[model samples]
Target: MLQTLDIEHRLKSTLDEFVADWGLDAEITAETWLVEDLGFDSIDVIQFIVAVETAFDKRNVGFQELIMQDGRYVDDLSVGQMATFLEARLPAA
Candidate 1:
């Protein structure tokens, strides 16, 4: 298991790099919105995923897995959530 600090750092780093590639500006604590803040739809999601995959060199990740909107959630989340998900799923070398 990854330490909480390590996980958060990795997540934030990935998010920052990805956002930069898209010419988006966001703080580490910024909450990334899907359709509103980031203006991202399905295609954008794929693009972001691909970007992240390359940056982290992780395998292709699915959309549904990162769209964690339940348990009092509804339909969306910030990029942090996605990063956290990816960090957890990273394959151990």
Candidate 2:
């Protein structure tokens, strides 16, 4: 039974690994913006969503949609936001 904080930690670690695997030179933190700060394009955003899903063992979570508005990717997607999203999906401990 993983707690929310535990899940969040795992998510952060997963994001770190994901970015490293992509060869992006950016500091990952709860406040780091996925696009502006990390330089993620649309394709990168899609792949990021996939990474989140895979890390959390979820499928079709539509993570990209959360950070989009009017069919455009939002410039802000912090690591904290991703953790919160995954936290909501986690079962109560």
Please tell me which predicted candidate would have the highest lDDT against the true structure: 2
Model 2 CA deviation exceeding 4 Å by range: 21-25, 70-72
Model 1 pairs in collision: none
Per-residue alpha-carbon lDDT of model 1 for 1-93, expressed as tens digits? 444456557656765666676676645553656657766776766666676667666665554556544633235556667656755776653
**What's model 2's overall lDDT?**
0.75
RMSD, every candidate, angstroms: 4.1, 2.6
Which stretches in model 1 have alpha-carbon errors above 4 Å? 2-11, 21-30, 68-75
Give the Å shift of residue 16 in candidate 1: 3.6
Positional deviation of residue 34's Cα in model 1 after best superposition, in angstroms: 3.4
lDDT tens readout by residue for model 2, 1-93: 456578768877877887786677776777788888878888877887888778778797667567777998677777878777767665554
TM-score for each candidate, following the candidate numbering: 0.58, 0.75
Task: Tell me the lDDT of model 2 at 72.
Answer: 83
